[model samples]
Target: MSQVVLITGASSGIGKSIAEFLVTKGFTVYGTSRNPKQQEVNGVHFLALDVTKPETIATAMEQVLEKEARVDVLINNAGKGITGPLEEIPEEELRSIFETNYFGPLRVIKAVLPTMRKQGSGLIINVTSIAGYMGLPYRSAYSATKGALGLTTEALRMELKEFNIKLTNVAPGDFATNIAAGRYHAPLKQDSPYAANYGKSLALMDEHVDHGEDPQKMGEAVFAIINEKEPAVHYKVGAYMQKISVFLKGVLPSKVYERLLLNHYKL
Candidate 1:
């Protein structure tokens, strides 16, 4: 039997690409959106799932299990983007992003573990970001959320290994997606102290996303990971430079790396 795969945030962008690609590979794919307009999309079933909502997560899981009996793979891809000076971003917004990006995935994982444990084999992929590897100017909250998720996955992987279940983190760099349109931006206050630098950083982030790699590449990378018999706990998909930045951080002195980031962002 073909594996049953479930992906969150699959209405568009990277999630959509992954869902469509997996369908071609003969997996019974279920893609989810907060508001699904159709029951099927490009050979993938559409389910309504809001990661922040536990009831919706449970409902979606139940729907999938009722039809497929088991979900062989779970992709935690539903996440929101937030960018602003940490000092100026509202506390509520920070909490909201954490709910969507960090706690949301954890909630879904908890819901699925019982089913996977019964099956005795399964894989969970948490979609993180290259930004998670380091702090970025004006994107601190976004970085923190991903970083937290990544670290949690590291711990969970060991805990789940005994059950023959696998967990991994896939950190993608900026992709040409609609993420920018959905990202929350603190107002560019005319009198705010961070106006100038924050504005520059925000514009640069948008520019990167506008010209970033195709989402299909991410889809392909994920497909390969699913096929692997023994996958690593952490996988990074991005341009050479973006991947190298993480390596550089490890080798370079802390202050030097900080200066490099400052120069790159033109701060």
Candidate 2:
């Protein structure tokens, strides 16, 4: 039988692209959404899964396990986006994003571990973001969530190595998708101290998403990582500069790197 692959948040965007691509490659793909409009699409089976809800996560996994008997790969692609000045961002919203972006992935991983350990061979890929490498202005919440997930992936990789279960994080830069529409943006207050800089930064961020690289490129990247004999703990996919920014932060003086970010956002 083909490798059984389960992907969360597969109704659209990067998750959907990966799901469709894997189906074409002959993997038995089960793509999930909080509310799937159909039973299947492009040869990928649709399941109802909302990462933020533990009950839904459990139900989805149970359904997949019942049918497949073994899951070869688990893709934690479900996440939410939030942007605003750190001070202006509501505490509840900050926690909400973490629920979907960080804790949700952890829950899914826990749900699948037993089966993966039993099989003695499995791969778990967490879809993170390039922003996770550095905190972007007005996007601190999003960056923090992704950054936390990335770090968690690194730790989990080593802990699960002896079980023959491989784990890795794939951090993608901006990709053309509907993410901007779904992201939570703190209302731009005209009288707020951060009004000018925050407004400009928010516009720039949306424009970047509007013109981001094709989502299919991300699909291809994930496919390549899945085929690897021994994949690295982290993989980045995006524009050259976006990937290079991560490296620059490592080598440049802290103040110098901070200046570069300020200039980039024109803050």
Candidate 3:
């Protein structure tokens, strides 16, 4: 039987590409976004889902179950980027980021667990970032959310092992995605002490993202993971990211890593 995969944030970028790739590989692909009209892809079914909304998640899952009766893979890829100094970020904005990045996946996992448990096999892939493993200037809020996701994936992997559910976390470095161009925003409060530094950080981030890896590569990596009989717990995509991971593991100390990041971003 063709495996069924549901991917969130499929309107664009990595998620959209992943959906397209899966369909090409003979899998039943269901792509989700906040607005179904926003999805222009033809082969996959686009479902309306707002990860931050509980009712929306529940309803989408019900509809998927009704049609397919089983979901073999769940890709938690719906997320936004928040760039700015940690202190300059408002509490509300931080909460909002976590809502979409962290709790959003949790909600979807909860909704899908029952079905996966009943089936005795499933794979959950969380699209995190290299930022989740190491901190970078001006991305504390964003990185923290991914950090939470990393930990969540670890715990879920252990707890769900007996049930034959595989959990994998994909940590892509910078990717050329609409995330950098379309939805990124600094926190609303204008009076923070780190405002100047925040501005500088955003400028640097913009420059880096412009030259980042292709989103399609990320999609290919995700497809490979989903098709694997034994998936790894963590994967680092992107050329620069793989090198950085090696450096972090072999040479850089925590303090040295912090200094390197700060100097790179001029923070």
lDDT, each prediction? 0.94, 0.94, 0.85
lDDT of 1 by residue, 1-267 (tens): 999999999999899999999999999999999999999978999999998889999999999999989989999999999988889999999999999999999999999999999999999999999999999989999999999999999999999999999999999998999999999999999799998998888889999999999999989999999999998989999788999999999999999999999999999
Error of 2 at 115 (Å): 0.4
Better of 2 and 3 by lDDT: 2
> How far does residue 34 in candidate 3 sit from its true spot (Å)?
0.8
Higher-ranked by lDDT: 1 or 3: 1
> Which 10 consecutive residues of model 2 have the lowest summed lDDT?
77-86
Model 1 off-target regions past 4 Å? none
TM-score of 2: 0.99
> What lDDT is reached at residue 166 by model 1?
95
TM per model? 0.99, 0.99, 0.93
Q: Could you give candidate 3's per-residue lDDT for residues 123-239 as a string of tens digits?
A: 999999888876667788888999899988999899999999999999888777778866557664568787777778777778768887888888789888987899988898987
Residue 218, model 2, lDDT: 83
- Candidate 1 lDDT (Cα, 0 to 1): 0.94
- Per-model clash counts, in order, read 0, 0, 0
